[model samples]
Target: MELTQRIKQRLREVEDWNVVRDELETEAASHADKSEQSRALYDLARACESVFLDKAHAMTCYQQAFKCDQSNLTALRHAREIYQEMAHLEMVARLMGLELARNTDASIQPSLSYDFGMAMLNQRKIDEAKSHLEAAQSLEPSNERYSDRFQEVLYDRGKWQLGLENVMVQLRALTGSDDPLGSDVVKRGHPLSALFLRAARILQQESPDDPKLLPCLFKSLDADPSNDEAGYLAETILGNGGHLQHVQKLQDRRIANTDAPEAKLALMLAAANVWHVRLNKPEMADYFYHQALDLAFNEAIVDVGWGSDWFLAAYRRLAQGADESGNADSLVPLAERGMSMLGEVDCSILALSAGELAWKKFKDVDTARRFFSRAAKLAPDHPQVVAFRRAEGLDDEAKTTKLPAMAPEAEVLTRELPVADDDDAVDVRVDETPRRSTFVDPASAAEPEPTRTPEVDAEPEASPEPEPEPEPEPEPEPELDVEVE
Candidate 1:
């Protein structure tokens, strides 16, 4: 053939390998005969591999060569090599599977089947991996690696089956179904739930605004509420207000269930979000927000295992609600309670809020200073903390005022009580007689009393002195007179 001669002549030329590859590719395109084209493409692929080291391009050429001639073992081997090096395990598995299917030779089938099985294992195609691996083991019972890989596949398959059983159980729980046969179907584990969740996640990542994703996410969550990814998708759904009726139905069901605190919290958060964002009813939103936070806090406190982190998250939601409602006054108490309840937890927002409220709303400079100082301690580099400190001149030293000293007379006077001694005692007597009248009645006060009293008193005054003692002794002798007296 002219093309083959031209290809040989071009290969012998002193031209660059790239030029030779281009000429061969041109020759390959020009040829109408499948055999000639296959030879030219194969040569071109070799040129690309040796000179350019472009395995991907060479693989393409080898694929074309194999399509032109199915008996092209070189093309198959080179393509398989390139795929293996690229870690295209799925492609290698497919290629080897096809080779095994086409080849009737038992010896070559065992090697190809083993390679296919290994590739399938790498691709996580466990069932196919198991089948081909078992076949290889049967063909060459002495191959330990094939047995090991097969055992691994069997172990993975068992785990996969168990996971599917769990998913089915969750599905039945969500749907409130009593189908006994559902377990049988999922006992071997179909990948439906995982596949659906994966697809939903892909949709969320690729086309978030696509209308179809909401239902997918909702289904994922409905199947398993414990799925954190599904929960996030639910949040996104709620945020967009995409399915209010369904959300409301879920909320109603969760609210009716008194025993499920976590479910109730989730529903409460959802309701709060709906009210705050969609309905624009901040008061109602605040009510639900507080309810959810209260529930979470109670659950955490009762050792229900809803850790302190959950309580802190609830507190943050409450704070967010307060902020959204424009209730700065509420933030004061919230910040205080948050600090007390979340001890040692970083509460910079609460501290900043408390400081701002103290400064602006309460107008208490000292309280504001204390709160701002706390905020600074918590987050010194926070913008609000820095701004507040700068605005209040906290970075500056305080000016001191001195008062003049008091004079001696201006000093405070203190009285001291005299102490009493045990031996020191005093007694005093008082007169009870009434005082004489200073004025006399002129008609009634005659002078007759003065003369008779002076006559009786004068005799005693003259006789008095020495005889008085003897006379007293003589009078003592008269017992009768003394007794009568």
Candidate 2:
């Protein structure tokens, strides 16, 4: 019997969809044509979905429908929707590809192609996504979303050079305007900064020292000076002499014009490099370094990988110079300031050095012990910390007792006793007598030896004169005189 005729007859026999559904299922089981079976299953799925609201049964029916007839658009659409919602992006992309192949009308091609491309993109199918997105953009050139998505795909595929070219095109359009800052591109999205940053990153990776990268970095900084990456790249380029004079001039101008803390900080840092490297002014260099450090603590300077290390090193140099000059007073303050700038963990070695200087030169055991203890807290088992602890008598084996001063006459003594010879058979008995203490009273002991002063010790020792030669032995000069005569 025809499946439709059976469904109709069953519908007339009973107004219940359950009866019609059961009859259709029986007929579908025995149906000869796969198409008829697919229709029956699809109808049953609709009935289950609309009447019973059973998504699982509807999904099963849709799958069966698609299996029976590959051309079943409705079934494919429903199944694809479910898969998409389930985040089965690969399956969604495949189904969309099939749908696109089925639909050939130009009116619907753009939407279908875009959907397929987005699905592929979600699945990380970059090449396929780019192809489809490009097609969609060409079909509808005015679609901003398509253009944006295509650009994203290009970037994802590591086509940074192409991305940079597109960015340059946009930048040119904006900069060509009478008021670039008020241009639509800037008002909509200052993609200029992001593009510059991306281009800079690509160039940096490809050839860090390339001259072209300097312009990109500078453009990025111009777009947004607060950009940490741009600042870092600019600093690196200028430091390496990439447009050094021009960048320094611009930085100086920006510093003079802008009161923004981040800008000032970056500019001051660059100025410091200029002073130290180009101008050869140590005083100005130190001044800028300190200014940058101060600004960093108070302001939100973007961390361009210059955090505390530079200042800490400068402080160390100063402290070391002072220590070498035997100016303990100056060394302590510098080291202490450095320790405060950098945490205890990073500056523990500085602390140890200061402790040693304090103890050895200043004889300030308390200060030395305090510094050592702080260092121990940071690195308990450090070699220097352990050595300092032991040297300061703070170790486990250290004794607390203090011995009294020795007496003046309590000196070391050496004596030898003679032994009897065994050759003579005679009695040789020697009496054993106890020795008396040789220590003398303090009042009777000679005056304590005077301590030697450096000036006195600096004097040269005196030496005896050389012996005079004998007059007769003074070479016979008379021999030559007699010959001349």
Candidate 3:
């Protein structure tokens, strides 16, 4: 059943392929030995491929050859090549899995594992694909294909949906003139956009001064325009890098263009800072700040950092403006909003400012006291609180929000005590408090009313001048002598 090299070489002639294929098939069927039958069938499959150009028949022959003799995994490889040429990845994986299960060859396992991983990935078996891909990379660390594909899988495998979308993006990019993408993709969690974001961050970390950083960041946002973090990052970079004009254009294009709350909230904060901090256009800043804050307060968006630094900064500016203008009607709501997000501000100062605004702007003394109390509670020992409390009394339930721990004696008085008789009540209360002696200053004492020292009596009082006391004689001479001794 074995075909010699001479016959195989002759079989390469296309004109005689049908004759040779028929002869090989006859020989394979005649073999009683399975190994002999496998060899003859392999020759027949090759004739079918190279001679007849019949891939389907070639694949059938290859599979039959492998089944006849498991020792010839070459048959499976030939079948796999056909499946791969047809782009039938499921079949390729199935064939490869079978070959690896049966073959113990170490030299080819890495390539096999790699191919299998790719097939699994296309099949949407993410975690399994990762393992196989990782194994291939581990086995052959020098192979960049193995390692790079493995990393690509790592980038998105944490979420299967994202990984699947990422793969789809990759596939689509190859299938047409360009990638299938748009503004709405970010709202749907576009994975290509996420990958671009990671690349931009790496570029920023590795080469902060590189000119490519801005473009990379822009590309990420372009891939997913509604990405809040990417939008804010680009805004910050553009703003701080003296590209304020470009930043304005970027915000103008992104802000009102998308209905995404996160996009608007984050971008608005950035816009506010541009107007408020860089340009000193408070009127414009006020609009953007209110836009961001309204969304933030209404819980329409999550933390876009409003940026990492901008969220807190925006509120601070608003509060400062309110205090400086001396006319903000929403001062109470501002304080409440600021205090609610405690970590975003120097809360004691914010509360203190609100209290000042309430008192100075609107003469809202009670509201001022309420905020002052909160300020004191947040920072019990703030110098401003101390000075205010010392200079002016805020006496009421709202005077103090919190106090230091009571001293031991004071603590004892605060505890409830059993009632006692009226006589014992006085004693019990007095015993708990320290006794004190009262003193009166002569200057402060009321003088007795001048009675009828009438007109006639005033003249008679001149005789009383004899009441002046005589000077006492000195006994100092005797005392001095004893001291000297």
Q: For each candidate, give its TM-score against the true structure.
A: 0.29, 0.28, 0.33
By summed lDDT, which 10 consecutive residues of candidate 1 come out lowest? 476-485
Candidate 3 per-residue lDDT over residues 324-362, each given as its tens digit: 322255546744653443431234445665665676567
lDDT of 2 at 41: 78
Q: Highest lDDT, which number?
A: 3
Query: Could you report the Cα RMSD, in angstroms, for every candidate shown?
Result: 48.4, 38.8, 41.3
Best by TM-score: 3
Residue 453, model 3, lDDT: 10
lDDT of each: 0.47, 0.50, 0.53
* Candidate 1 runs further than 4 Å off: 1-15, 28-32, 154-485
- Candidate 2 local distance difference test against the native: 0.50
Report the poorest 10 consecutive residues by lDDT, candidate 3: 476-485
Decide which is better by TM-score, 1 or 3. 3
